[model samples]
Target: MKPFHHLYGPVPSRRLGRSLGIDLVPHKICTYDCIYCQIGKTTQKTLVRKEYVPVMEVIEEVERFLKEETSSIDYFSLSGSGEPTLHSKIRSVIEGIKEITSIPIAVITNGSLLYLEEVRQDLLYADVVLPSLDAVSSDAFLKINRPDEGLSAERMVEGLVQFRKIYKGQIWLEILFCRGINDHQDELIRMKEAINRIKPDQIHINTVVRPPSERWAVPLSQKEIEKIKNIFGDKASIISEFDRPPFSLTEGNIKEEILKILRRRPLSLNDLSEGMGIPTEELERHIQPLILKGSIEVRSFGESVFYEVVKEIQISRP
Candidate 1:
């Protein structure tokens, strides 16, 4: 299979299964520079919405991949290195892909722009919309998310609430906790109140399980997160590791395939093994040479070690 410009991964997702990621915007162009972001710090933080990537090009690539590959992807995920809603023609891209395949579409967003009618409308066709609400108070929101100017915590909550009223699809609201930042008692109470108003179909509680952009961003213990999950009520659950059985790594060169997936996000040895359907011992053989050549580097977050491609290295076809 040839390299695709706007498409990536049928990578294992903790939430969406084997998700084929569609990048609508460029890397790090996001509204919030969240401290716990696994993909690193946001480079171009903005509220402005426009066609950052060509809509037709993205659609064409999806069509090409569908024709060339026979991987059983669970969802066509509108997520990548940056916030997807920033792409003005994302609705067009979603509609175009739906026309070609029966696969469900999922939109993973920050929910910052959901206050706008257009943004909410753009995501209506998606099978599931996973939007995050880490904090309900302005101070906590600012500290945790570090959003662009003019965006407030109240507006963010309101957007989710408004979207719940209109969207018939599933709304899985994710709340990522960073130790003391948004996990305080006051913030938890306010977040619970906001969740009541938003009425999301599911509430996924997450801690910083991956390496964060800020070193100070720390994760809560499993026990602590479970307590918060109880507080959020019956609908809430912790976002755990992807536990599904591995899929066969059909077609692509193993070395090139590893780089392709790692370029989008850091994955542990087990994550790569599960996503690639290869054994850890065999993967280490391919990984060691890359590490020696400085093509990829290892990072530890909590107890898990992850591999990420060095940003400066260009990914040329093998």
Candidate 2:
């Protein structure tokens, strides 16, 4: 198979299982520069929606990958290093992919653009829309998300409420709590009120599990999150590790495959093991050499250790 610029992984996901990710926008162009973003700070933070990447090119890549790959994908996810809904022609991309395959479509977004009716309409065809709402109070929103000048916590909450009205697909609302930022009692009260109005099918509670852009952006403990989960009630649950059985991968070129996935986002050893279906011992053999040659480095976040590509190094494909 030739290299694909727009598509990556049938990577294991905690929520979406064997998701083949499709990148609609380039890296770091987003509406918010989140403190806890694992992908680093956003470079172009704006609310302007345009064709960031060629729509046809993305569709063609999805078609090609579907034709060549035999793995059973659970969802074709529109998510990558940046906010996907920022791409204006996302509707066309969704429509184009649907014409090619029966695999369900999922869009993982920040929910910042959902205030725009056109953006909601574009995502209407998706089987599941996973949108994040980290804070409901403007103070907490500003402190945590550092959104564009045009956006507000009020408007963002309203957007999710409106989207739930028109969108019949599943809405898995994710809320990532940052210690001392959005985890206050007042913020939680406001958040629960907003969640009540939005009425998502599932409320996924998350925290800073990866190395964040700001070192001060810390995670709440599991005990703290469990308490919040109880407040959110029956529909809410903690975002746990992917527990499904691993999928099979074609043997050989394990090193190249590891680099490809790590270039997108950092992954723990278990994440690599589950996603690639490669045993830990075999993967360690491939990973040690890459670390020795300075292609990737390990960073610990919370209790888990993650492997991320060293940005300055240019790793030639093996």
Q: Could you estimate the TM-score for every candidate?
A: 0.97, 0.97
In terms of TM-score, how similar is model 1 to the real structure?
0.97
Q: After superposing candidate 2 on the true structure, give the runs of residues whose Cα lies further than 4 Å from its correct spot.
A: 311-318
Cα shift from native, residue 223, model 2 (Å): 0.7
How well does model 1 score by local distance difference test? Answer: 0.90
Q: Write the per-residue lDDT of candidate 1 for residues 1-318, one digit (tens) a residue.
A: 668988888887989888899988899999999999989999999999999999999988988998887667889999998999999988998899999999999999999999999999999989999999999999999999999998999999999999999999999999999998999999999999999999999999999887899999999999999999999999999987776666666433778788889998899999888877788999999889889889999988778899999954544444
Q: Global lDDT of each model? A: 0.90, 0.90
CA error at residue 309 for candidate 1, angstroms: 0.7
Which pairs of residues collide in model 2?
A: none
Q: Residue by residue across 246-299, what tens digits does model 2's lDDT show?
A: 666655557777888888889999899888888888889889989998888999
**Clashing pairs in model 1, backbone N/Cα/C closer than 3 A:** none
Model 2 Cα shift for residue 311 (angstroms): 4.5
